[model samples]
Structure formats: C-alpha cells, structure tokens
Target: MNTNTIEREIAIEAPVERVWSLITQAEHLGTWFGDAGANIDLRPGGALEVRWDGHTLIGTVDAVEPTSRFTFRWHQLDTPAGADLTEQNSTLVEFTLTSEGDTTHVRLVESGFGSLALPAEQQVAMHADHSGGWPVELGHLKDHAAVVAA
Candidate 1:
C-alpha cells in the first residue's frame, strides 16, 4: 500500500455538544449507523462491538476528548467479495468536531490503512471502500442530528 489515508467531512446544522452526543450514544448509533441493537461502551480502552445483521465489528476505544474528538481501533468482518479482503486492520477512525457559531464541522479522518493484514493491493481497496462509506455515514449523522435539534 502507499500508506494513503481516506478522509471525509460534513458540516452539521447542530452544535458541537449535540453532534458529540449522537456519536457517543450507542442506541443512536444503531438507529442511524448500524444494527438497531448495537452496544457501545463510550470510554477509552473499552469494547466497541456491533453485531449488525450477521456481520460483527469489534473494536476498542483509543481516544475520547469529550464532545470534541474520539478515535477507535476496529476489526470488521465481510466486505464486497473479490474487491479486497482483510481479517483485521489496526486502523484509526477519528471524529473531530469544530464549531463555527451555530454549525459544527464534523471531520472523519481515517488513517493507518496500510496496517491491515492483507496484501498491499487489498489494503488499497479497503481504503477505497471506506472512502465512500464514511460520507454516507456522515450524511446519516447529519440528518439524524438535524431531526433531533428540530
């Protein structure tokens, strides 16, 4: 892999505190991001596991800075078949919340793509997969927050 990273950002029409609460809440996550029953322990070094449908994603909380920033380490099962594959990846997903007056800028910066347990080609493909995935997730987050704020 070329050690390249994928990043996506979205401006939410909500305050930093509102955005932060949505991301940290496991029940809200399930309603918008993953399976409806997913559970999250929002503490550093805690378990972050989500069992969505038949796919399971398990990770650990790496960093948490109140309603400002949070990072995690993840391992996901399953992907688009024949695109690329890795059993585990020591990747970093960071959520940075910055407020401009009333709106909050939510930036999702995911790095360490080359640390995945797969061939260089596969790692690159996985990066591509996430490159698209994060935007959709953020869109969902934005809409969810807007509804809650309303």
Candidate 2:
C-alpha cells in the first residue's frame, strides 16, 4: 500500500559517534553502499555518487547533523549522470540516528516514488527493488559497525 516509500530501522552495535562516522565518511560508505564505490561530499548541497551495478546514481546532500541525521535526494535507477534532478525525478532519503546507551538506533526512510514521472511499471519496479534492498543494506551497515567496534 505504501509504495511511495521504503523504511528500515537497524541497531548497530556501536556508539553513535562511530556509526555517524561510518555513515558520513565516504570510504566506509563506498564499501557498504555500492559495489563500484561512492563519493559523498557530506555537506548540505554537496554532491553524491554511489555506483551500483555499474550505474552511478547522482544525488545532492540536503542536510547533515553530525551524529543525529543525514538527508539527501537522488535520482532513480537508470538515470543518467548530469541529468537535472527534479522533484518528480528524485527521491528523498533520510537517515536518522538515535543514541541508545552504547548502541545506535538507525532509521532510514526513502520516499517520493509516487511522484516520479516514470512509467507506472518502472515506478513499481523501482519501488520494489528498493523495498528489498534497504533492509539488506542496513544489515550490511550493522555488520560493518560490529567489525569496526570489534
């Protein structure tokens, strides 16, 4: 019913400070996020590129709040680089981290699928693709954090 968004929450067995660095730092993000790699500016209005299966998804950072939150807007699957990102062509991704004693509670939400100007089939497919992928990626983050904490 909520094809417009995908949400995943994960608990990383690490402090908020460490998890914040893992998420915001480009080197860590590249390994856990995309196969080819990623380059993130990590500031508001900065550029973001995460390569997945040979496709480089372009995005712009919208917010950064140290260990608390990070947000961005990125174009969908098959979108070409250098293409302008309009509201109908991109989705907003928000990462919210809540400190829980020595652990970090991470909640990720990606929305805007219903507004995409893509064909109905493509929209549904992309929504489905991300629906399945976010949990796995969050799992990766959790595992990676565990390693780093170890």
Candidate 3:
C-alpha cells in the first residue's frame, strides 16, 4: 500500500441527495463537523481548517463537483499539542459521494504528501498516520448524517 495516500470509505444511511447536501453545504458542515478546526468557505479557492480539541488542520479547496465530489489541498498546521509541524504539504484531500438507493457511499482520498514540505521520514509517517485516521473521521460524518436524515 502507498503510505502517501489517505483513503477512507463509509456508507451512510441517508439518501444520496441528503448526504450530498449535508456534506456540500457550508452551514450543515459547521453543524455536524464539530468545528474540528473546520472552517469551510464552501467555494473553490476557499480555505478550510479542521480543528479537534486544540490542534488545527488547514487546507484549501481545489474543486467542488456540486453534489458529487470535492477536492482540496490539505496540510497539518499544528501537532497534537498544538505544536507546528515543520513539514507541511504532506497531504491533499478529496471527497466523493454517490447515491445508491437509500444509501450514500462516501469516499475520501488525500494524497500528494509524498513530496510536500515535510522531511521524507516524517512525510511517510504522516501518511501512515492518516491512513487510519481518515476512516475515523468519516465515521463521524456517517453518524452525523444518519442523525440528520432521521
């Protein structure tokens, strides 16, 4: 497996339309995304910051595919203790949502960190860390969407 890639997939109990709307809308994002350093401009070329606890995750939106997909350039602005990560740009995030009957399939891919601002070792480590981390984040999305749909 390529450590430089961050991929996560989850199935939500909401319809494709509902899931799409929740994920794409800035207001809905702020509601369920729990402010995890998350700041959504909701437009192309806008900024995104995902914060949890006290740390911050920063990124820029690269593209938005209406109700289908979204792409962004992602970086870790601060470490666990709010320490700045010297190696930035080791990440990029893309989200794809598909509707299948009453279920929505969400796929998240974050890559491009292999050649970012981080040292080679740290970059690889970050990639590995994100590999599992993304799924957990998606789980949050899944639960949030489920509740809203109900």
Candidate 4:
C-alpha cells in the first residue's frame, strides 16, 4: 500500500485570488493553521514558520506559481522546530488552486512519509496524524475565507 502521501481537496466560495492570499499570506495562515502564529516569505527558497502550542514547524518554499501553486518542504512532525529540513527529515507539501465561476478549488498534497528516516512506527503515526490534520486545517481555511472575503 502507498502510505506516503495525504491529499485533500476543498472548494471555497471565494475567488482564486482570495484563496491564494489566505494560504500564502502569513496573516491568514496563522488564523487557519497555527494557533500561536505563522509567518511566510512567499517565494521560492523563502522561509515559512508556523507556531502552535509551543511547537514550531519550519518550512522552506520550493515553488511559487502565484495563484496557481505553492510548494514547500516542511520539517517532520517529530523534528525540532528550527532543525534544518532534509529529505529524510521533511516532507513535501504542495497546494494547487483553480477558479470555478465564483468559487475556488484548492487541492493539497503532502508526500514523503515512506522515505522518512524516522522509525517505521513513527512514520506511520506521523502519516496518520497529518492525514487527519489536513482536513481540519482546510476546513479552517474555508471558514477563514468566508470571513475574510465577506
């Protein structure tokens, strides 16, 4: 079985531009994502940080395609907040967007669980945690969009 990736899709009532802003902008990310705060540089090679419950997750932008796609490499769940992200210690997250009339489609993908250097049990647990977490985060994003776009 392929347990290396988690994928989620959500349709938002906001335009593509607004959805893109909500995901890429630090202000919106913190609200829909980390409870403490989030900050992003929003360009390839830029830094992304999300803080929640005293734990920080650091990421580096891997690609930026404006309102269409944003990709980043994030530290694994068990890794220390500020540790350097390596292939064995991080996973790839990609966000893709498409505009549909008055709404926007957001597709999220996080991969690399099978290749992580962590123990097999740890890898399985991380995959399960993320599989469940992404949906909630996307829901927050959709709700946040309604509030922001109103």
User: Could you tell me every candidate's TM-score relative to the true structure?
Assistant: 0.85, 0.92, 0.80, 0.93
| Candidate 4: residue 55 Cα off by (Å) | 1.6
RMSD of 2: 1.6
Candidate order, lDDT descending = 4, 2, 1, 3
Write model 1 residue lDDT over 106-138, tens digit each, in one string.
888888777666787888888888887888888
Q: What is the lDDT of residue 79 in candidate 2?
A: 59
Worst 10 residues of 4 by lDDT: 76-85
Q: Give the per-residue lDDT digits (tens) of candidate 3, residues 1-150.
A: 686677778888888778877776665665555454357787887876665667555666778888689877755544444333232533567889888888888888877767666677887787787776777667778877867745
Which candidate model has the greater lDDT, 2 or 3?
2
Best by lDDT: 4
Q: Rate the local accuracy (lDDT) of all candidates.
A: 0.76, 0.87, 0.70, 0.90
Between which residue pairs do clashes occur in model 1? none
lDDT of 4: 0.90
lDDT of 2 by residue, 85-126 (tens): 777889999999999898899999999898998887788888
> In candidate 2, which residue pairs clash?
none
TM-score of 3: 0.80
Error of 2 at 43 (Å): 1.2
- Cα-based lDDT at residue 73, candidate 1: 73
